[model samples]
Target: MIKKIKKLKKIRLHREGTDTLVYGFIVIAAIALLLWRFIDSKVPFWCFTAIMGTVYCIVINFFRCPIRFFPEEDTTGLVVAPADGRVVVIEEVDEDVYFHERRIMVSIFMSLFNVHANWFPVDGKVKTVAHHDGNFHKAWLPKASEENEHADVVITTPEGTDILCRQIAGAVARRIVTYAKQGEDCYIDEHLGFIKFGSRVDVYLPLGTEICIKMGQLTTGNGTIIAKLK
Candidate 1:
């Protein structure tokens, strides 16, 4: 019974848009079958039905829905990675837009196949939530971190630590979702929002914080510790 429950949970994850290729193939196959049946048979009624069904499946699978989650656990001091992707950059940079100071910037680049969920990196009260309208460059491009359409979330921990997380839209990703708003109490590893399709997540940590992961490392949402405040 225990093993069965675990299997069920795994099935749920796979069904929730995580296996995008499998779902895409299924949709394409259904559309092909419908087209063959109606267009070849000269069934006018079936042709209309098939066209609608094909369009519905394409829209629903591509943009209407996405899979997101956050592990329910106490995550304080430790910085949780906000998205599943490869760590592209981890360096000290001057943040002029929001924090107005130097910080350790950790950027994760998500491909089309990655889980797009974004999670809070620390338990804190949201201090600010800002969205900027900008260009949609390739997500992995270095300049995309600052110039791309994105949403910024700043959280102030009980200990007075300031943590910042950003959801950046790529050339293929046009939507950025953020659930954390100013003054809301956000727990670490809690579900904050999501980014549709390929994108990137940038986490800015205050100076003096020790980073746990290195450049080129792969991280999962709420599972990989990006850093810890000293």
Candidate 2:
């Protein structure tokens, strides 16, 4: 019960951001101290301090990794969202790179303020994890799905359904971290990876899969159902 209660907390700092937050705080503190000692004008010191403090607050918010899980006990045939953001796309596209056929693509675009941590979208065994080096495009654009640097994790469900989860780097994002390993089992509650800064996640479902989300709708990672596999 105690663990569950803690998991239900509103906010928690992710370990991935520990170094960043600690270093940011130190750097900001040093700058503020320098200003206070060297500058005679109190107004400029306070103004600089206030601005930098707010900027660090925004960075803290960006690194937040809220504990989340699908509320239901049964997860069979259900595909949960992998990241928190707005559903920027829901369309059927030809996925030539992996599937070599048509698939339904559902994309969630995370802004700098959203949690950068990613979660496994399904309960399955990871088929493979692939990372591609490419240009960083704006994540919301369609071309970003292919042109942007991304990490792909493919999982085969217990029922033998294959799903592709891709994490795309955005214009501001430089790193894509993927934790899912080949042949490893993954669950909806387990984190798949973390993307630094702004980015997006794309889930490719097999043709005929029923999508539960709509374009422009906000989705909570590990909580919102992305689709129902047939």
Candidate 3:
């Protein structure tokens, strides 16, 4: 009963400022048809309408923000997935920004059709937030972690375990939004931020952390448990 209420309270529409784009496209489609009827008689009306309809559908789904349910039990050491997507990369890598040591890197790749909302992986205090400007490379590439523009958010657990989550911009994704701030307390599965379009998020877990998801496995933001802390 309590979980249901919490889920209902968390249900929300996509972030503000996106309505303008949705309505703008609809308006443009209307004007386009009017102009086409008067100017371009050779162009088929059905073709234009179909193209516009397809674009509108895609745009609407891209900005979808669905309500998610957090775990009802204790989440002390559990790390939930921060975004909805497929696990693309999982390996050990040297993290230079915060950990400056070897850690397990679990990467989730968000496609245009996936929900881009991000959430906190665990209950902790925000330790640091940093942004880096770099080339917008394809997010799936291994080099994109360092070469692509990204933002890093590090949160320290009550036991002093620091987990790092990074938002990476892809070739098509130009903006990365991060709501986490240094010195703020964050709860597991709580809303952290969002990525506008196709992108990727990397979570650096401490060595020997038990990873639950496998590569290519689909994950739901705030609903899927990714790992368990030591």
Candidate 4:
């Protein structure tokens, strides 16, 4: 059990091997170039410049990456925010593909510095998981939620009520990772997946669910109460 907990925390760390590899490659290449220059021309200035530049890039990327997760308690009848970001939009939107009807849409915009992990909004069984190929637009752009490349995961709680959560790619985000699949048992606060860098998450709630958050409000994934079950 302790090992599992440690593994979970490790997964939540945003800077994995990919970030390390990228940073290492740039730093190593810069160092190598500087060494060659110093060996051939006795120019020590180039080495310092390369090392500083590489360090700066590594620091910026490491600090800006975001990681998040959801609560583990049963969230039946409650609507939890899926990502950490500012609430950008809340309106009635037609969602024909999954809900097959008009639903209340709550869109959260995640900046590059915000946590990019997505969480299950309710304790339930994964009813459907769909991925759509589309364009990558600015995350806060009005149409990005509907038009950008995204993946939708719908969960049906014990009461048989449906909750839809989507991870949408932003201008800076190129990939959406999801772990939930249809019929999979998922608990509230489970780490469903993550969005690389900046992105947005659109949560579709049943009409009449009281939205506790307003536009511009900052929320934490797995921690914030987005709305109460009606």
lDDT of each: 0.77, 0.91, 0.85, 0.76
lDDT of 3 by residue, 22-117 (tens): 686879677777867776674656667778778777877777777776845677788999999999999999998777899999999999988888
Q: Single out the weakest 10-residue window by summed lDDT for candidate 3.
A: 1-10
- Candidate whose lDDT is highest: 2
lDDT of 1 by residue, 1-230 (tens): 01111111121232234455567567667766766676756565466557766764554444322333334334457788887889999988999987799999999998876777677887778999999999999998889988999999998987898888999999998878788989988875456777877899999998999899988999987678888888
- Per-prediction count of colliding residue pairs? 0, 0, 0, 3
- Give the best candidate by TM-score: 2
Candidate 2 to truth, TM: 0.95
Residue-level error in angstroms, candidate 3, position 199: 0.2
CA RMSD for every model? 7.0, 2.8, 2.8, 4.4
Which order, best to worst by TM-score? 2, 3, 4, 1
Residue 43 of model 1, lDDT score: 68
- Clash count, predicted structure 3: 0
Per-residue accuracy of model 2 over 129-161 as CA lDDT, tens digit each: 999999998999999999999999999999999
Give candidate 1's TM-score: 0.75
Better of 3 and 4 by lDDT: 3
Better of 2 and 3 by lDDT: 2
